[model samples]
Target: MNRRLFTAAGLALFATASLAAPALADSLDQIKASKTIRIAVDLGSPPFGMNDASMQPTGSDVESAKLLAADLGYKLDLVQVTSPNRVPFLLTGKTDLVMASFSISEERKKVIDFSEPYGVIQIIIAAPKSVTIKDLNDIVGKRVATTRGSTNDKEVTTQAPQADMVRYDDDATLITALISGQVNILASSPQTMAAINARRPQDPLEVKVVVKTNPYAIGIRKGDDALRAVVDEWVKTNLRNGKLNAIYTKYNGVGLPAEMLK
Candidate 1:
């Protein structure tokens, strides 16, 4: 080789070796060493995640995160955040994992790796007590409300092109719109519907499952094997121990599937 080629080759090897060096501890190891496992918790989504009068987080997602941390031998650190911010929290190292009841999607999977599903539920259409709608066909040209930026909005738009969709910033806003007759139907994940049912049993709204959504996954920054593997293992263990089923029963008021029960 020429002299210029030889020098370039030497520089390339030096940079490659330096770049391949590993960190002091991988994400999982660091969490274990620190005895702290930070999880993204959703304070808005009910049944799966929410806060009580004390403003402390509790629900299926919170319980799942606690068990995951216990399996990893660390104390769970609940980092409360909104739906839109959950993935960002993981990417920015603000949280170790997202157990915030976020749904899995093909687009999201490309950016962040998700664990095997801890749970899955379809989005349902909730009609007001007076609406005579039996299905999507009945809602033609009617105003529908969905949580803004949720998969429910995307799914409903695809299924009901003629229906008008009004977007709300959160679950509360969506429910308010439906109950107030501002919108004829509220579309959302079953978790949200379950939460609403639990909160208002007397004047219960009817839920018709329209779309069976993919499972909810705990998100980790992509290519973070150390953390992903640990979380995956934790999910398996939780499923086997009936921890997840217990969580679902306790907070969601519904029993989980045998498959998720592991």
Candidate 2:
């Protein structure tokens, strides 16, 4: 009655327990043999998995992916995808793993397995100086911009029902609205916020983080423990050797929390 044996026998009853462990390793080994690791990502979310000005992948998550691929003796192949498509890419075998600042969700876990967290996420609010909004309540009856289908959009809508939630199609549009003073506030992922803010040195529009923190991780398909275990252990060694912290501090505030490292 081994779980692996049950899954191999095609019994769907214990699908979760049986299939999860073996799928991960099979994917990783296939990549190793091919000498190429296909990683799904968001090239638009700066400082996390975005492409640099050179169009090469550069950011906390991307850099971590490079190391992870190298550790597995494979070259990393980056595939640009939106927030909406990351999970699908992995589950379809079109992507070996997703490192696009993919957030861990309970519902997602039912469909996709996730490695231990490799990064952190925080919701930040940006507004023109004219608005003296210090918190979520200050934006009542005002327009706020966030990427459509983003968790931040849901958070803002839940918190300020009186506020008009303007859901933009992408993070770029949300940033444009905030900078042009088209919206009272821009609520977006902190990773994108930091990269955009870093470029606007003289701009008066300021960003303030105003929400709970969350962790990020690579998303593997639900039955893939082999690849998941490799990614999880790779992150640990990088953080222990200070390479991981160096990458995050290069862009974001600092490395993952000490507890997260553990």
The candidate that wins on TM-score is 1
lDDT of 1 by residue, 1-262 (tens): 1011111232222222212112233577778678898888887777778788897777789878887777777888889888766655665577878887777876566456898888876777876476677788877787778888777888888999888888999888776665555665677865566555555666566765455556788988766787888778878877888878788778765566666774
Per-residue lDDT for 5 in model 2? 16
Error of 1 at 173 (Å): 3.8
TM-score of each predicted structure versus truth: 0.72, 0.71
Which run of 10 residues does model 2 get worst, by summed lDDT? Answer: 1-10
State residue 68's C-alpha deviation in candidate 1, in Å: 1.4
Off by over 4 Å in 2: 1-25, 127-135, 141-149, 164-170, 182-184, 195-200, 203-209, 252-258
Candidate 1's C-alpha runs over 4 A off are: 1-24, 128-135, 141-143, 164-170, 180-184, 191-203, 257-259
Clash pairs, candidate 1, are none
lDDT of 2 by residue, 1-262 (tens): 1112122223232244323222334786788688899987787777776767787778777777787877778888888787765655565567888888777766666667788777788776776566687877877787778889777887777877787888889877777766565765677765555545565555645565566677788887755677778888887887778787787777685456777655
Best prediction by lDDT: 1
> In model 1, what lDDT does residue 170 have?
84
